[model samples]
Target: MADGGKVVCVTGASGYIASWIVKLLLQRGYTVRATVRDPLDAKKTEHLLALEGAKERLKLFKADLMDEGSFEQAIQGCEAVFHTASPVTFTVTDYQVELIDPAVKGTLNVLGTCTKVSSVKRVVMTSSMAAVLFPVTPLGPDYLVDESCFSDPNVCSDKKLWYVVSKTLAEDEAWRFAKENGIDLVVINPGLVLGPLLQPSLNFSVSLIADLIKDKNDTVNKNSRLVDVRDVALAHIKAYETPSANGRYIIEGPIVTINDIEKIVHEFFPELNLVDKNEASEIIPVIYKLSVEKAKSLGIEFTPTEATLRDTILSLKEKCLV
Candidate 1:
């Protein structure tokens, strides 16, 4: 797909997963119009600029999520748009301003440009698993979630699931806009994405792992799924390139408990000081499973859980992040 003239645009190019997408796109020889909040901020974009083929193939554009026409120039001639930008943070003061506005309004702003730009053929949206399930509650063992399910926004709001609410509303808006305007849209719903980050600082997902290792809290009782950041980026490309790809694809690895992660850490780094292994903690039973058959049908082989977790820790250590 990357034949030099095949241009694609990635919003929030300096982010954790988006950076990998930009890197992969540039390495494949595609002309990439990468949007950042500030293109001139060397500290944020230096790593991106240093990537292979970045000098010639990558063009940085200054774009903000809230601004109405901020992403238009970047999306002008692109064949595909990878909308990976969203305000993601666990700590929230104002849900409306911090999470909702940037997610819903920013998504509309981006898709609104697609209506004007005739060259855009497809859009691969970066939606989260949070859109599929409520944040605080675990799915029952009998409950299984696929593309068909959506998190109850009412539940999210009532429970103060701010981040989940943002993602759910944003993705809902994207689907509605695409259907109404005849724009082809594909959504990638990923679990907690973690792995080697091209960007310098640790992302929210990776930070959670760091906190877990520090044993700051007894979160071992909670069970959740994870996907490698690179795998998630690849899923975005696959969703865009595959002709038959339609609807939402859940890109997740295996469901694991926090104790499972601790076991893997012990196997990989035995010398490091870890939470007391002898501490008996109740194993959190898996409530439900996220279906990945749809993603696998598109020929995406997910990285193994152990390898994914190992790479995440090693990368954090290399960056002196953990």
Candidate 2:
């Protein structure tokens, strides 16, 4: 185990990425205060409690993102806060009510609590590539998307890409709040996070993969910048631990298409039937690159796309999801 006496609070402890963050933090011997929607939810809390060292080092507290001051009890006395809790759904009847308010307001609520606690030295936030890349603009092949890029909320709203809008707005608010309050903030913007699932439920990204496997003709033509869940979890910790780390870091592996995923699935499990690349609909591949140099500087070497895909499929199989 790594040397860890520091106390840290992780919001949204029951989430796909947050669960891994909690697991990793416990492995390092940190006393973790994890916030979930309901501590009594067995499906969400059981796997967390089962983690190695969790019995001694992990504590779960109930916290609702939209509920003001709900995070205070969990965040008090923590040296650092890892704010990973946010809505991840794409299909919502009310985008503002279901996604935007929770993401933006919930973030401020967490930061507000942090301001009251003097022990908090830094806050590591989980933002998404959706904040960096959307509104569907055409870019040159040489144009590398970096942390500097911000998705246009106007465009996202007009396009009904409310999830992108929420992430973009929430991250924007976080930076503004951090600046005004003199808070040490580090944000990790991960691409489509795919790897082994720690939570019992299927997240949007993993569900996309599972849907493709279960359906012979369900292949998307868009390109996706992928990253392993474990790497994303480590990046959060790295951003928190590295003294010189600042601002935003884009965490991703490689840019791949749906066909690439299908090929990998076929390679690993030949018995499993998948959509043939030739039969899959093809659209003009988006030509752009994601810059991960800043994240790499934090000493995070990402997992290979093949290995991530393999692990993702294996995890789904283990859960009987695929």
lDDT by residue for model 2 (1-322), tens: 3465689999999999999999999988899999999999999999999999899989999999999999999999999999999999888999999999999999999999999999999999999988887745646677779988888888888888899999999999999999999999999999889999988878888988888887633535566778999999999998988989999999977767777888877876788776466544464555776678999999998899989999999998898887
Q: After superposition, how far is residue 153 of candidate 1 from its true place, in Å?
A: 0.7
Q: What is the lDDT of candidate 2?
A: 0.89
C-alpha lDDT of residue 238 in model 2: 89
lDDT of 1 by residue, 1-322 (tens): 5665599999999999999999888777789999999988997899899999898889999999999999999999999999999998978888899999999999999999989999999999999999997744557887777888888788898988899999999999999999999999999999889888788887888887777666665544466688988889989998988999999999887877777788877776787677674444455577786688999988889898888889988888788876
Q: What TM-scores do the predictions have?
A: 0.95, 0.95
**CA lDDT of every candidate:** 0.87, 0.89
